[model samples]
Target chain A: GIQVEQSPPDLILQEGANSTLRCNFSDSVNNLQWFHQNPWGQLINLFYIPSGTKQNGRLSATTVATERYSLLYISSSQTTDSGVYFCAVDRTLYGNNRLAFGKGNQVVVIP
Target chain B: EPEVTQTPSHQVTQMGQEVILRCVPISNHLYFYWYRQILGQKVEFLVSFYNNEISEKSEIFDDQFSVERPDGSNFTLKIRSTKLEDSAMYFCASSEDGNTEAFFGQGTRLTVV
Candidate 1:
């Protein structure tokens, strides 16, 4: 089993501010995903960057597989961005393709 | 974009009653998955289905739990006997491929009294 740990379990960012959240894994993984759990508890997929970097508008993510860590960047955040951000990893070699998720980073973007 | 859809957004059942959670994955998707999130806890994987059979399942999916594709369009998770601990938000997801991106549905909140 892989171990995933997220940084800053709780984060508060004023609207229009920028912040970075991190995820560290104990071992190498073949799959990695970033999700946003909305207020209503819908898990929305944000990025599936197992390695390298990807950007989506005001949001971006970079994964350095060698370091076994990934970073998510949110710029000019808005109130709607307030939610729980999760980093999940899948180790295919382990029996099933189950994703081990981190505790999550609870982001609060205040006005 | 076509997305996964689940029915019975919420369900309440007795401790020993059986419950079924239904999901309709993307029409073109080839892989399906079931996950549950206990209140205030991390999302946990329950099982993964593909090609009409279960490809894999987690320890939580004991003999009491099962999954099936009754027809061409529906994928279902069945719990033989529910328990208080089974109460959680169950999520259904589908992926274009087994080792690719997965899209999740809104999720069904199961409450076993």
Candidate 2:
């Protein structure tokens, strides 16, 4: 099983501020995704980047598979962005595709 | 976009009672999974189902827990006897395949007293 660790467990940012969250994994993964659990508890899919970089609106993510680390970047943050951001990964061992999630980075974007 | 849908957004059950959480995964998806998140804790995987059977399960999923795709479209998790610790937000997710991104439902909040 792979271990996922998210950094900056707690973050408070002013609206319009820019911030970055990181995720590190212990082993190689076949699948990686970034999710935002909003205040309403809806798990919104952000990105599924196993490698390279992807940008969606003011949000972007980069995963360096070789380095076993991924980063989620938020720019010009808004109050709506306040919630927990989780990074989950599925390792390739034994063809097991179940995801293991990180502790999550709790972000509070103050309006 | 198609998404996983869970029934009974919130449920309250007495300890020792059996509770079943239902979910309807995306129609085209082949892999389904159940995950739980205790308040103030990280999300943890419970089980994954494919081909009408469980592919993998975590230690958290013991004899008391079971999963079934009773119908072609419905996936359900059954807790034989609920406990106080069984209270959590249960999320149902589905993916097209093993190497794809999984989409999660809004989640069902289960509280066992």
Q: lDDT per prediction?
A: 0.93, 0.94
Candidate 1 local lDDT, residue A36: 98
**Sliding window of 10 residues with minimal summed lDDT for model 1 chain B:** B94-103
Candidate 2 residues lying further than 4 Å off, grouped into runs, are: A93-96
Error of 2 at B17 (Å): 0.6
User: Candidate 1's residue-wise lDDT over A15-68, tens digit each?
Assistant: 999999999999998889999999999999999999999999999999999899
How many angstroms is the interface RMSD of candidate 1? 2.3
Docking class of 1: medium
Residue B63 error, candidate 1, Å: 1.4
What fraction of the reference structure's interface contacts does model 1 contain? 0.53
Writing each residue's lDDT as its tens digit, candidate 2 over B1-113 gives 79899998999999999999999999999989999999989899999998988998999999999999998999999999999999999999998887788999999999999
Error of 1 at A60 (Å): 0.3
**Model 1 Cα shift for residue B8 (angstroms):** 1.2
Task: Report model 1's TM-score to 2 decimal places.
Answer: 0.96
> What TM-score does candidate 2 get on C-alpha atoms?
0.97
